[model samples]
Target: MKHKTLVLSAAVGLLAPVMAGCGDSGDGSDSGSAIVVGTTDHFTATKPNPAPFDPAFAYDTGSWNVLRQTLQTLTHVPRGGGVPVPEAASHCAFSNGNLTYSCTLRAGLKFANGDTLTAADVKYSLQRVLSIHDLNGAVGLLTNIADMDTSGRDIVFHLKSPDATFPYKLATPIAGIVNPKQYAPKKLRDGFEVDGSGPYTFKAEVKDNTLVKGTFTKNPTYKGDLKVQNNKVEMRVYPDAPAMGTALDKDDIDVMLRSMTPDQIKSLTDKPRKDINLTEMPGLEIRYIGFNTSAPIGKEKAIRQAMAYVVDRDKLINQVYGTTASPLYSNIPAGITGHTNSFFNQYGAQPSLSKAAQVLQSAGIHTPVKLTMNYTTDHYGAATAKEFQVLQSQFNDSKLFDVTIKGTPWKEFRPAETSGKYAVYGMGWFPDFPDPDSYVAPFFDKDNFLGSPYNNPQIRGQLIPKSRREADRGAASDTFGQIQDIVADDVPILPLWQGKQYVAARTDITGVEWAVDSSANYSLWELGKGTTTD
Candidate 1:
C-alpha cells in the first residue's frame, strides 16, 4: 500500500500535433502510423497478444475491447462514480422489491466472432466469476449474484435476498461478459491477445505490456458512440518514472498519461511552464496495509495497530511521495461513499511506542519480535523504496519489532502475496468501479478475502448485504460505518494514505477527462488529440 495510490487533463503541450497514427481518438489504438506512447517498461512487442483477453484472470482494466469492450452490462457507470444505466440491456424491471431484478437486452448485440451476445453469455460470465476463484481478482465482484436465468435476451437475477445495489455492480469489469467458446474455463491470460465487440480489437501486444490496436469494424460496434480519430495506437512501457520522463523529453512519447509529484511536474512546468500542460485531480485513490494475520509476527492485532501508529503516515506522504499523496484514515478514501474518520476516531496522530509497549507487555509478548515487511520494488517506483526504508526505520526504532525487509519485482510480487509468502505486505488498489463496494469487497469478506484473510461476520454476512440492498446510498452509511469500526478493532490491515494522480501531455492532446480515480483506462476511450469533447 509507496504506501498506496490512483487520475487526468489538458493544455498547450509539446510534441506538436502529429499526423502520426491516424490522429488520436479515444479507441486506445494507434493506426498504421504506430503512436509511440512511452511507459517505463519499454513496452516494445516481442510476442503477439493472447486471446480470450479476459479481465477475470487478472483485474486488468488496461485491456481494451477484449473483456470490457465485448461486453456491456445491464447498466452503465457515470463520470462521478455513482449509479448505473442500461447498456447492453435496453431496460430493467426490478421485482421482489429490487431483490429480483430483470433486464431486457438490446437487440442486434453480438461478439467480435459474431456470437450473439445473449442472456446465456451474461449468465455464463457472472457464474464463471464464482466458479473460478483461483484466478485471484474475479471472485469478489460475483459474490453477490445468487442465481441467474434467461428469458429471450432478458435475464433475471434471483438474489438470496433483496438487494437494490446489485444493478450498480453489473458495471464493473469483473462482471464483464466473455465468449464461452474461445477461453478454456479455468485458464488465466498472461498476454495481450484479445477479441471483442468494443471500439478496437486486440491487434498486437508488444513487449512490456504495450497493446497494439486493430479495427473494431465488427458486430455490436460502438462507432456511433465514439469518434474514431486514429486507426492504430501504441502503448510504450518503461521500467520507471525517470525513464518515462526521458521519453517525453526526447519527444519519443506524446502524452505522459499520468502525473508525478508536484516537484517533478514543476521542473518541466517551470522551465517554460507554458510549454507543458500539467493537469491534476485530487481525492480518488486509497492506499492501505494488511498485517498478515497468517504471519507469526502479524497475528497479534495489537502489533498491527502499533505499526499503524508508529509509522508516520504524513511524513511518509510528504517525504517519500512528495505532495502527490494525501493521507487517508478509511479504506473508502475521500470523494466516495462510506468515508469515515473511524481509523483516526480510534487512534490519534502517530502511535505511541510507550502505549504500544504496554499493549504488548500486557499481552505478555516478547520484545525484538521478528517481523518481515514485503514490497514490490519496480512496480511502485522510487516512492516504494523510500516507503520501505521509512517503515524499516520505524519498526526497528520501535524497540518492539526486530524487522527484516523484503523487496521483489512485480512479476514475483504479484503471486507471492496471493500464495501467503509475506508477514506484512504493501498493496495499492485501483478501483474496478466507482462504487465503494469495489474497494471494500476486494479486501474483506470471509470467503472472498483477498489476503491476510481478515474475516468479520458483521461485514461478510450482515453489513455488506444490507448495504447492497439499500438503493439509497445515505441509508447504506451505517453498514459501511460498521465495517470501518470493525476494521479499527481487528487491525488486520492498517489504513495508509490516498494518492493524487496527474497526467502530463503535450499541448495538442485533447478530450481527456481530468477527474476519476477509479480506473485509468475507463475514460481513455474518450481521450483524443488536438481537441476536447464531452
Candidate 2:
C-alpha cells in the first residue's frame, strides 16, 4: 500500500490576502509561471530497479505522482473522490458475472511521442507488468486476471475469480498504459523519461540513480477526462522534512506535499503564516509493524501476539505524532467500511505486561523474547526514526521483550523487507483506493504484496472473496469484521496509528484540495498559480 502510503500536504480559504499580494483578483483569471513542488518521499532506482518511473514497476506514491501526470490509466478515481471513470478507455465495465472486464479505447489517443494508443497497447501493458512481476511492482493486484485479449478497439480481461474491485485496481497507476515502442515487452525499460497520453509528459533528472528533479510539461496531444490548469509542474526531491520545509521558506518551492513533520505541521497550524496555506483533510494512512513469518523468532505467533498486546498505540501516537494521528487497533482504519477494533477488543485499552507474558507462556515462548525492530531512515519523514525509537522503549519496558532498533535507508530498507531480511519491520499504508478491500487484500491476499510470508487461508480464501462479491460494499462489513478478528488472533501485522492528511502550499497556489485528492494521488494538472475559474 506504500504505493500511495506512498506519501502527504495546504488551505485555499485562508489565503485571500496572500493571493492579493501575489496579484490575483479574488476571481479566477490570472496565470503564473511554472510550479515547483517539494517533497521528502524517495524511491529505489538502483540495482534490481532499472526503470524507476515505469508504471510497470513504480508502485509508491512518490513515483506515482510523477507517473500519474505522464501515463494514463484505463480508468481513474475522480479528483474529488468517486467511482472509477474513463481516462484512456472511453468506457469500461464488468460482465459475465464480474469475471470478465472489458474496455473500449478512446479514439485518436496518442502518446507524447505520437505513438497511436490502441487496445493492443493496453493489453501489452497489463501483460508485461504481470510478466516482470517486480517485487516493488503492483503485480499482486493484477494476479487475479487470468487472461486478457484485445478485440478490435476493445480489451477484455478474464479473471480467475469474480472480483468487483478489479475496476478499482484499474484506476491505479498499476494499470498505467505504456508505449509499446518505448517499453520492452518483458524487461523494465531503462531511462528517466515517460511517453504516454496523459495531462503531461515527464522528463526526470537522476543523480546516483536517485531522482533529483522531475519536470512535467503539458501534453498538447493529451485527450483525457482531467483538465490541465498549469502548463508545467516541477517536482524537487528533498532528503527530509526539514530540508523540504527550508525550501518552502526560501521560496524555492511553491508547494510542499508528501510530507511535513508533525512538529512542523503543528507550528503552522498553531500560528498561521500569512504567506502559507495549510490544507487539512481526512487521511486514510495507517502505519503498522509487519512480521516476517518465515523467520525463526517471527514464526512464533504467540511472540507476535505478546508484542501486539504490549504495544501502547495511544502512547505511540501521542508522543510521536501528537494530535496529527490516532491510535489504530485494526488493519482497516476507522472511516473505511467494515473497520473494527479487533486488537482493542482482544488486548483492551492499555498495555499489559501480564497479558503479554501469559500469551508467551501459553505458547511455550521464553521470557524476554529477543526482537529487532527495523525502519527506514528517510522515506517516511523525520518522525519515523522517533516513532520506532518510542516503540523500542515501549517493547522493552514491558519486560517481556528484549529489543533493538535498526534504521536503514529506503533504498536498502525496501529490498530487505521484500527479501525477508528483517524478522519484523515497520510499514505504512496509503490505500490504493477508498475501498476497504484495498486495505486488506494487499496485506493478506494469496499474493500479498508485503513479502512477509503472511498467508491466512481464511482471509485469502473466504473473507476477501466474499467481501468482493457483494456489489454493495456495506453488505460485506461482517465479512471484513471476521477478517480483522483473524488478523488480531494471528498478529501478522500490528496496527499502530492512522494519520491526518496535511498539505502545505504558498497562499497563491490554487486547487490544493482537488489536486491531492482523497485517494492521495496528486493530479499535477489540477494545480495552478492563480485564482482558477470554477
Candidate 3:
C-alpha cells in the first residue's frame, strides 16, 4: 500500500492566515544561483555541541540535517515519499530466508576528496559505526546485523533474523558512507572536517560554536538522485527562534529551517507577514513522558496508569502548542500506517480524576500520592517549564497526588534520565525512517532507547519480530495495534501530542514545502532563491 502524503492545510480561526506574497515568483536576476539558510540549532564541534558533523557520533536532528546533505547512504527516501530507493547502490535485495541482504554499488563513485568509493568503503563505514558504538549514537539500529561482507562491488549483510525494515534502516544518515582514507575504522574522526560523497561537502571553519560564514558549494563527485538547484548554499546558526526570526525579517537569512516554536508559527500565521511564507506539513515527531519502571514511584503499575489518566492532552495542545500539534493517543503518530487512538479508546478525551483516584485506591495507595516529575527545559523548549507547571497543577488539583517538578538542561538531563535518575521524565522522538516499526521497535525492545526497565516478553519476543517479517506495511497494522494495546495496559509512557512541520522562508525563496523528506530531514538541495523565469 502507498503511504499517504501529509496534505498542507491553512490555519483556521486564530491560526487563519495564508502565504500572502510568498510564492514561486521572483525577478530573473540571481535565478538558479545561490541561497542562504538560517536555523536556531548550533552546528559546531565544541563542548556541549550537539551538531557534530560526524555521522557516527551525532544523533540529534540538527546534526542529521547537515549530515543528510553532506553524506550518501546505500538507500534513501525520495523527496516525494514512499519506500526506500537505492542511492549509492544500483539495486539491493534479500535472500537466504531474508537473512542475507546484498546491494551492488553504482560504479565509478568517488568521494569529495577524489577517493574511490568502493563496496569495501561501504562495509568499513558500517563496521566503524558498530565499533565505536557511541551510547548516544544510532548504532543500536544496526544491532540486527550479525555480519557484513563485500565481494567485488557487492555489499552483503547477514542478519540474525528476518527484518523487513532493514532496507529502510540503511536509508538513514546513520548508515551514510564515509571515506576510509579520511576516517579511522575503530574511532570517530577528530574535528569538524568532513570528506563525503554527498550533494554538498562540509565547508568553512568551526569557531565559537558556529560555522564560519560562507557558502557550501555542490559536490562534483556526488552520484545521487538529488540535483543541486543552487550552486552555493550558506547556513547560519542562531541562538534562538526569535533571533532567527529577526534575522529572517531583516533579510539577513533567505530561509528559516529548524527549531521554530509553536508560538512563532502561530504569530506568523495570525499576522500574515507578506515578506515571510509559512508552510505546514504533516509531522511524525511525538512527545511523551516516560516512566522509569524500575524506580520507586514507577514500580507500581497503578501509579503509572494514574499519571496517564491525569494528563490533560487538550490543554497541552491548545495552550502550550497552539495549532502546531494534535493530541496523540498511541506511540505511533498519525500519517503512519497502524496508528490508532488506543489511549483515547482506553480512557476518554479529558482527564479522569475520579478514575485516577480509583486506580490508586485499588492498589492500596494512600491519599496525596507523592511523585516527582523530571523534564529538560533547554532541550524541549522554554515553554516546557510552563507545560510541566500546568501538569503539576492538574495532578495536584485532582486532590489525590502531591507532585514536585524538577528540570535540567538537555546535556545534564539526558545522562540522568538514561541512568534512571528520574522517576518520571519527558522525552520526544523523531523517526529515523518513516515506518510504523520505527515507532514501536525502538522504544519497546528489551534494550530500548528509554533506558527504563520496561520489558514485556510478548512484545519483544513475538509481536515486534512478527511485525518485522511482514512485507506488507498495512498488513503489519494488526501487530502494531496489538503492541499499542499492550502499551496502553502497561502505561510505561504517557503520549502527549504529535507536532506538525513548519518552515518559514522569504517571499523570494521557493520549494520550502518540498524541502522535507519522508524521514523528516530538511534538504538543502530542494531550496532555491530565484524566479521560475530563470
Estimated TM-score for each candidate: 0.84, 0.94, 0.92
Candidate 1 minimal-lDDT segment of 10 residues: 1-10
What's the lDDT for residue 226 in model 2? 86
lDDT of each: 0.61, 0.82, 0.78
- Provide the clash count, candidate 1: 33
Q: Which residues of candidate 2, in runs, are more than 4 Å off?
A: 1-32, 531-534
Model 1, span 1-534: residue lDDT tens: 001111111111221322122233344333344344544322122222232245565553343223454455557654433346676778876788776888887887777677777888888777776776654565666666788899788899888776665776676666666778865566655565555445455455453454433222323354223344444445565666777788888887766654344566556545544334565555456666766676777788777776766767887777777666777887777756577877788777776788778777777888877877888776555577778788788788888888788888755675677767777888776666555666677778644445546777778788887777767666677788888888877787787888765666655455433212335543434444553232
TM-score, cand. 2 vs. native: 0.94
- Can you write out model 2's per-residue Cα lDDT over 1-534, one digit (the tens) per residue? 111221211122322221222333332222657889998887546786667788778777777778888888999876555567888889998899889999998899988888888899898988989998886777889988899988878999999988878888998888888888888888887757777888898877888877888888889999888888888888999988899999999999989888889998888878777778787777788999999998998899999989888898888888989988998989998877778999999988798888889989998888788889999888777999999999999999888889999999878888888888999899988888887898898888865678767887888878899888877677788998999999999999999999877788876787777777544678878787764222
Tens digits of per-residue lDDT, candidate 3, 1-534, equal 344223112111112124666445743233655688877665555444343667677777777887888889999876666667789999999898778899999988999989889999998888888888765667778888899889888999999899988988898877989988777877776556766898888776567655655456789888876766667788887767788888888888888777788788878888887677787676778989899889888888999888888888998777788887899999998878899999999887899988998999999999798988899866555567888888899889988889999988766777688778898888888888878887886688854666668889999999999988877778788999999999998998889988877778777776666676434587778777754321
Q: At residue 343, what lDDT does model 1 achieve? A: 76
Model 1: how far is 498 from its true place, Å?
0.6
Model 2, C-alpha of 440: deviation from truth (Å): 1.0
Instruction: Give candidate 3 regions above 4 Å deviation.
Output: 4-17, 26-34, 43-51, 204-215, 517-519, 532-534
